[model samples]
Target: MLNPPIPLNEMDRLLSLSDLDLDYAAHQDSFKDLTKLAAKVAGTEMSLVNLIDSYTQWTISTHNLELEQMPREDSVCQYVLMGDGSFEVEDLSADERFKDKFYVTGGPELRYYYGIPLNVNEHNIGALCVVDKTKAKELNPEKIELLKIIAGEIVNRLKYIKVIEELKSNLSEAKQTQKKVAHDIRGPLSGIIGLAQLISAQGEDNQMDEILEFMSLIHKSGRSILDLADEILSADNKKDKKTPELKGNEFNLLVFKDKLDKLYTPQALNKQIKFTVNTSLASETIPFSKNKLLQIAGNLISNAIKFTPVGGHVIVDLNLITIDEVQHVLQMRVTDSGVGLDEKGIATILGGTASSTNGTGGENGYGFGLVLVKHLIDSLKGTLNITSIPGAGATFEVNLPQ
Candidate 1:
């Protein structure tokens, strides 16, 4: 059913290979002219120099209504292979070998057939099949000699097309290489961006305020570089070729919350905002990479700080939850008591999705962080959730299996 019976007339299926050459001619300059010359020289309605493969007969050049290609079993060229010289059927229906063939009855009602094999340099590529609906003009020795000469030129064209395709492939590869280089550089570039922000925000002041700003820059820039590097390195795994090793370790949520409070202090001061960290659960330990865990916290904390207004308070609470009725989890709630996010932002943060938007202070970041955070949490067998009021603030919760 891949190629349901392509009905060609006796001549169409026979020399109607003309369409093959015509269709492909535009694609390759090497074989195009040869097909046209083969048709004109034979004075046929359709003609083609074909390349017979295992299952299909393809044309290098074609003229008239012949097909671009057809199944070898269905091809008139397949029948022509039985003879040495041009296989000529002045009238196919009257011929014993072909009268029973489907094409003579309901298919492209082919009546006349003639094809001169184009074997050259040990390659039996195809034939210069000159076909017509009416009886073909009887070929004399002179015409047969001319057919041989024309077929030779067609072979030369095939060689040229092969070379052209090779060149096109090389050009495509080079372009992809250039695109990959640009994509790889985005990671390191983010580091530079963070450094630049620290310097600019400092405004030539070597004061404690400027140094703290610089430190926050280092934190953000370092995390961004690591995330980018991780993605670049894990791309092979993401492509389904390998499994990524899960990375985690034992750490305290209380201490982690304290670090966030300190890191976000500069941000809070800059916006004249109040930042708070509160927890009612017992301070316990859990297994997860501290550095990566910090990033997950940093991304959420930074986002909270970014959206929170001056004098507005951001509360971070660690809640203990039971998981699988077997163990306990130290879930962290980072809630910003300022302007909240839309449903879309909540989905992105919880689901690790995407969008393009600058922070409140014109801070630019690739929203891919949320996506990475989601993958990391899942890798650690954890669930993340986000809740928010339009003008109040947002609350993000992380639930992990103990």
Candidate 2:
């Protein structure tokens, strides 16, 4: 028995096939209708949409036959990938290439075959084929033209599936990020309230110096929060700018560090947890989105303070390390001495699921903060590492490009 020859562009063809991420099971009905139409038009007993990969011929869709997959060397449709047009065999018994094959000689004793290459992105990855047990002369010039049109439709459907899959993924990411940003606003708002209470108490004692300092910090934090909210609202109102929240701009890291310290210090002191923000930096100016960094760092510090018991320490260490001559990476580490995470709890956090647990001070959380942090890290093309023991402590390390 003669086997089908491999195409010269086999590597590229397989790569393109895998990139489609085709889920044949989900779209079986779509392919089934097309294959059914091809068989009806060609007056054949069976039809197949066979996708050829490195070693297997996958029957993604079929009509009038029950088939799944087979070796590439044993597939009659593999030969269609060698040319740019249809491959037809009027009588399998008379053709040397497939005359002694299983389907032709033993299984179905198929005598007629007509196939069109499924072309996409300058590659023929598969074939749309029809087969019969008799040497049929039913595929006229008009019928062949109709079959080619159907072949184009199959490729179009594949392209549509890729587009839809991408859209769904982008939509999901946007929704998750938005939720994280909304939750982040609560941090600064709480800080604002704390500062106001402090100012009122200082006013009764006529401590103008401290009151003025607190007012300055409040103004800056309020402006930053407003800017973040405006960006989010603009992105929602403007359908074109779907991801404006991720846009980057130049900002001073020192200013950001001060805001973070002011925001979390009161909360930590209220809980009797020692919160320290340590920074070792060669440059304070970083070309990255300030709001995104704020959200990431805010969530980490908040979680640390929440989990640590009274008299425990929660430290935030930040530094800029050289990645190359032209690039630097911002490394932020948050460590806490409190009830740490087990392996299962770590998995739930990293898996982007909500895992609710009460804090050492009985503080409640939505449990999606870590999930949001992970998604934001991925979006920034950064890395996150977590280390913890059940009762000792936990440390979260994040490195982002600047």
lDDT of 1 at 228: 69
In candidate 1, how many Å is residue 117 off? 2.7
lDDT (Cα) of model 1: 0.60
CA deviation > 4 Å runs, candidate 2: 1-3, 23-26, 195-402
User: What is the TM-score of each predicted model, taking all chains together?
Assistant: 0.37, 0.50
Off by over 4 Å in 1: 1-36, 55-62, 66-75, 79-86, 89-94, 102-111, 118-121, 140-146, 157-159, 187-402
Instruction: Report the lDDT tens digits of candidate 2 across residue range 91-189.
Output: 998978778777888867889999999998889989999999889657789999999999999999989887876676678577758956866885777
All candidates: CA RMSD (Å): 27.8, 21.8
How far is 285's C-alpha from truth in model 1 (Å)? 45
| Candidate 2 accuracy as lDDT | 0.76
lDDT of 1 by residue, 8-107 (tens): 2322232222212222323434555666776676676666666653224556556765455543444667655444466777887797656765667765
